[model samples]
Target: EREWPLAYVPLLIDEKEWAEISAGLVQRADLFEAILADIYGPNRLIEKGILPAGLIAASPEYLRPIAGIRPASGHFLHMVAFELGRGPDGRWW
Candidate 1:
């Protein structure tokens, strides 16, 4: 099933709706960048008591095996996924 895929009907949105969706996506990406930066950088949240140090260490997503190995490009948390949703008005945007 992974080798082949089915095509879906093309989605068409007005410029206004497209702009709203694009802005939301960009904002979310920026937020992810900030969170990742804090986690792998200075860790101000843990220092300032906003986030518990124990929680981060206990999380399964925290990769202890590769703790010391930094990416040459200095990038982490490279994947982000969002659910497609609609409001009560039934608009995807």
Candidate 2:
């Protein structure tokens, strides 16, 4: 399949647009890291009356198979990606 035909067009983004996109991605990654820390640790978000316990209980992907398995060295989130695209209205999502 190495010689399979492919169709692609190069995207041209300005420096300002790239900066905005990068900022949004970094913010999302930071949020995910905080959430993972809460889920695997003391869960102060729930204890402090911030996040509802039922919300966690109802999540399908909540700690099920790997309930008590801690990370190798306290590193929870290893990798993450955001599939963003510019919308018709020139908004990145």
- List model 1 lDDT by residue over 1-93, tens digit each: 744453487667789988998889879888887766677677887899988999989998887666545677776757787755566798763
In candidate 1, position 8 carries an lDDT of 83
Runs off by more than 4 Å, candidate 1? 1-10, 65-70, 90-93
- Residue range with the least summed lDDT across 10 consecutive positions in model 1: 2-11
Q: After superposition, how far is residue 18 of candidate 2 from its true place, in Å?
A: 1.0
Cα-based TM-score, every candidate:
0.69, 0.68
Q: What TM-score, to 2 decimals, does candidate 1 have?
A: 0.69
lDDT of 1 at 90: 85
Clashes of 1: 0
